[model samples]
Target: MNAVNWGILATGRIAGTFAAALRELPDARLLAVGSRTAESAEAFAGENGAIRAYGGYADLMSDEDVDVIYIATPHPMHHANTIACLEHGKPVLCEKPMAINQREVREMVEVARQRDLFLMEAMWTRCLPVIRRVGEWIEEGKIGEVRMLSAAFGYRTGWDPAGRLLNPGLGGGALLDVGVYPVALAHMVFGGEPTGVDAAAHIGATGVDEQTAMTLTFAGGGLAQLACAVRTNLNQDARIDGTNGHIDIPIFWRASTATLHVEGEAATVINEPSGYHFEAAEVMDCLRAGRRQSSLMPLDETAAIAHTMDRVRSAIGLRYPMDA
Candidate 1:
């Protein structure tokens, strides 16, 4: 197909963002949208300029014109939704954290592989131009043998016991909600699972972690200190310290600028567009190329990150209702 026909499986905030980004790509068509209700689906389709709207996910799935589906459902629903799309012979770009745990991620990956269909965790940061530059800087030895990393992603959402950010049924918590950013960053820089993980969390009255801190020790002696909180405000900055100097990324998750500090040299700034279109472009390219997974954000990497999150949750004694 010269142009990819996209189907959005949710009408939430993230789904809107993905739909808007898809509009920025010339080879992408926002063909269909689906929601739990016909009204919601029609509203989203009208707002996003989709050609068709379905009251239920199955209806959208049955639309053979949709070449791929973007699963923007909450974390708790990722497994079922992704599997459903793959089973229908439709490729998927599921939002992260791909699922609530590693086991679910593995199952999703297995289905994609078995069906020879495309499936990717929509960790948009992994496809950002600034992040690609960071990778290149690391490879060029600009940060000479990275030794330490520090990052945090947090916002002052206050406390809402029944809200999605604190609801156990929705897999709500700072870790899964925002903490995945720093953890994914660590993996991108360090390149694998940590040798050891030490963590602690503040489980609020809602039975979800309001704030959590972790220290990941890599096999090569590198360390990453990361934190995420839902009830507090944080710098939301990231730094990579190396033998020579450090690289600082402000608002790291969706960073547009990164500054590299080399020993006794002036800081150099790298900048790029901080939009979701890069990931969408990557998805279209992968589809056109007939690839099942992204090299930059592989399924194995997605599962490994889920494993790391599981370890963090274990260390903090945070259990979701779905874990049982």
Candidate 2:
């Protein structure tokens, strides 16, 4: 298998992780890393063996040697960065929460569809093998008719009002950061958008949400109860209950293990690999198959989740600095 020439579009922590892990894949390679500053891009790309360091993102996007561009920029910048990549006719795997708003997501989808380019919101969790196995078990009736889900993700963020967790300008708050994991998890297990949504939040001094709790009622007679907090760390366990049994993912947000407990049977531990490799593998798989979008991370599902999140943001009265 020939390696895909990957490009890292930002010098952030995720960019480094993806670059480092892609090297382990053997069939994937990092060709370039781009940053606003040449020094940072050069340093990052050099550290990861990328042949090119682009001082500007446009240089990376226009580089014919690159196969896919990873958009690791902030949520607020995702709109502009992804559009720039798509406009230049580059395949993109924009980071989680897809974009700062539903409108931004719609535009990204439209451009990609119009250009017939590959694009997906890199919600890496969907690619986890363990998550796939969990889905399999649910489909096989390990848990019949999932009726309820309880999940929470939180962290003691040290309360920096100007930091990404609290800055409205950065599209901060628990909902988009840690909260997205739980919400996405609910969607993954349930396999559809929430028909009803209710949410509440406590806004920080910077006007970003410090903590948020949401209840999403799915059409299939199940409810997902989720909570996220930047003010404190949650135990981060998730549970899915059904008529006859339940599965518990103790480390819900970034799970390494889950146990299924049948009504009259012993709990079974399902261990899984721990890393960002799965998401990269998905990218590799899609590129090799000449896919424009991931069926697992389909655009419609991404849009529905964004729509649900928009409602949650609206109900919490959360407004980012660039919301207009």
Top lDDT prediction, candidate number: 1
Model 1 TM-score, all chains together? 0.98
Which pairs clash in model 1?
none
Q: TM-score for every candidate vs. truth?
A: 0.98, 0.97
Tens digits of lDDT, candidate 1, 101-143: 9999999999999999999999999999999999889889997
How accurate locally, in lDDT, is each candidate? 0.94, 0.87
Give me the runs in candidate 1 sitting further than 4 Å from their true place. none
Candidate 2's residue-wise lDDT over 1-324, tens digit each?
A: 388888889998888887877877878888898899999998897788989999998999999988889999888998899889989988899999898778889998999999899999988877777777787888898888899999998989786777777888899999998788888888888888898989999987888888999999999679999999989888799999988899988776567888998889988899998667778888889989999999778998888788888888998998876678
